[model samples]
Target: MTRDQVLEFVKAHPASFMATVDGGEPRVRAMHTALIEPVGLTFCTGVNKDVHRQLVANPSVELAYWDPKTGVQVRVRGEMEHLDDLDLKKRIVNDVFTFLQPVVEQFGYDVLSLFRLAKGTSIVWRAAQGAAPMEVAEF
Candidate 1:
C-alpha cells in the first residue's frame, strides 16, 4: 500500500495497542488516537499515567492497530515525541475527545499529555490464517 493508503487505513482504525517500557519490563494498553495526520499518529494520556512516565523514561514505543472486521493489522515502531502544544490539547479535549473534558477540567490541561509518532517504520499485514509476517505497506 502507498503512504496515503496507510494513512486512510489508520484513520479508519484509530484504536491501537500501544507498547511502552516500564523500568526493564514492557507494558501495553489500548489507546484511541485523537487524530491521523500527514505526519503520523497522535495520542493523549494523563501525565500521571504509567504510559506517559514510561515514555518519558524511554521514548521507544510500538503502536499496533488491528481491525477485526477487515482482518488487517498495522504496526508502527519509533520514538515517542512529547508535544507541548496547548492548543492541540485544548482542541483534542474540547473537540475530538470531548469525553475527556471532565478529566481535563478536574486535573487541568497540564495533566493531559500529548504524544506523536511523526515518523516511523510501519509494517502492515493481512490475516491469512497461517501466513508469515509479510510486509504489505511502507511509508
Candidate 2:
C-alpha cells in the first residue's frame, strides 16, 4: 500500500497495540493514535504508565494494528521521543478532550501529564515480507 493508503488505514483504525521493551521482554498495550503528522505517528499516554516508563528505558517500539474484516494488518517499528512543545501539547489536549470533555473534566488534567510523544521513522509493513520498511522521518 502507498503511504497515503497506510495513513488512511491508520486513521480509520485509531486504536493500536504499542509495544515497548520491559526487562528484555516485549510489553504490549492498547493505545489511541492522537494524530498522524508528516513526521510520524503521534500518541499520548500517562507519564506514570508502564508503557511510558518502558519507552524511557528503550525508545525503540513497535505498533501493530489489524482489521479482521479486511484481513489487513500493519506493523510499525520506530524510535519514540517525548515532544516538549507547549503548543503541541495544547493542541493535543484540545483535540483529544473535545470528544472526551465530560469524562476528562471529571478525571482532571492530571491525566494529561503524559505528553505528546511520537514514533519517528515509522516503518509500515503489510505482512511478513509483504513490504519493505519505509522511512517516515528522522529524529
Candidate 3:
C-alpha cells in the first residue's frame, strides 16, 4: 500500500490501539483518531491521563488499527509530537470530541492534550496473505 492508502485505511478505521512505554514497561490503550491529514494522525487525551504522562516521558509509540471482519491491520510506529495550539485543541473539542465539551467547560482546553504522529513507518497486513510479508510505507 502507498502512504495515502495507509492514511485512508486509518481514516476509515479510526478506532486505534496505541502502545506507549511507562518506565520501560509497555502500556496499551484504545484511542480515537481525532483527525487525519497529509500532516499526520492526530489524537487527543486528558492531561491527567496516564497515556498523556507516558507520551510526555517517552514519545515513541506504535498505533494499530484493525478490522476484524476483514482481518486487515495497519500498524504505525513513530515518535509522538505534542500539539499545543489552542485553536486546534478548541477545534478538536468542538468537532471530533464533542463529549469533551463538558470537560472543557469545567477545566478548559488545557485539560486536554493533543498529539500527532507526524512521521512514521506503516505496515499493512491482511489475513488473506497468510505468512507473506506485509506491505510497508513511510511518511
Candidate 4:
C-alpha cells in the first residue's frame, strides 16, 4: 500500500495495539486512535498511566493494526510527538470522544495527554504466520 492507502487503512481500523518499551521490556495494549491525518496519527492516554510514563521515558513505539476481513496486518514504527495544544485536547474529549467527557470533567483535562505518531515506516504483512512484509511505506 502507498502512504495514503496506509493512512486510510489505519482510519478503517482504528482499534489497534501499541507497543512501547519500558526499561528494556516491551509493553503493549489495545488503543483506539482519535484520528489519522496527513500530518500524523493521533492518540490519547491518561498522563498518570504507565503507557504515558513509558512513552515519556522513551518516545519510540510500534503500532499494529489487523484487519480480519482481509487477513492483513500493518505495523508502524515511529517516535511519538507530544501535543500540548489545549484546543486539540479539548476537541478530543469534547467532540471526537464524548464518552470521555466524564473522565475529562473529573481530571479537568490536565490528566490527558495527546500524542502524534511521526516519521514512521509502515510495513504490511499478509496471510501468513511468519511471512515477510509485502510492502513498506514511509510517512
Score candidate 3 by lDDT. 0.92
lDDT of 3 by residue, 1-139 (tens): 7778878988899999999999999999999999998899999998999999999999999999998999999999999999989999988888889998988998888899999999989988999999999988886
TM-score of 3: 0.97
13 Cα displacement, candidate 2 (Å): 0.5
Go through the candidates in order and give each one's C-alpha lDDT: 0.86, 0.67, 0.92, 0.89
Candidate 1: what lDDT?
Answer: 0.86
The best candidate in terms of lDDT: 3
lDDT of 1 by residue, 1-139 (tens): 6677777988998889999999799899999999888987889998989998998899899888888997888888889899999999999998899998888878889988999988767888888744886674445
How high a TM-score does candidate 4 get? 0.93
**Residue 34, candidate 4: C-alpha displacement in angstroms:** 1.0
Q: Who is ahead in TM-score, 2 or 4?
A: 4
By descending TM-score, how would the candidates be arranged? 3, 4, 1, 2
Error of 4 at 119 (Å): 1.9
Clashing pairs for model 4 are none
Better of 3 and 4 by TM-score: 3
**RMSD to truth, every model:** 1.6, 4.2, 0.8, 1.6
| Model 2 worst lDDT run, 10 consecutive residues | 113-122
Off by over 4 Å in 3: none
TM-score of each: 0.91, 0.72, 0.97, 0.93
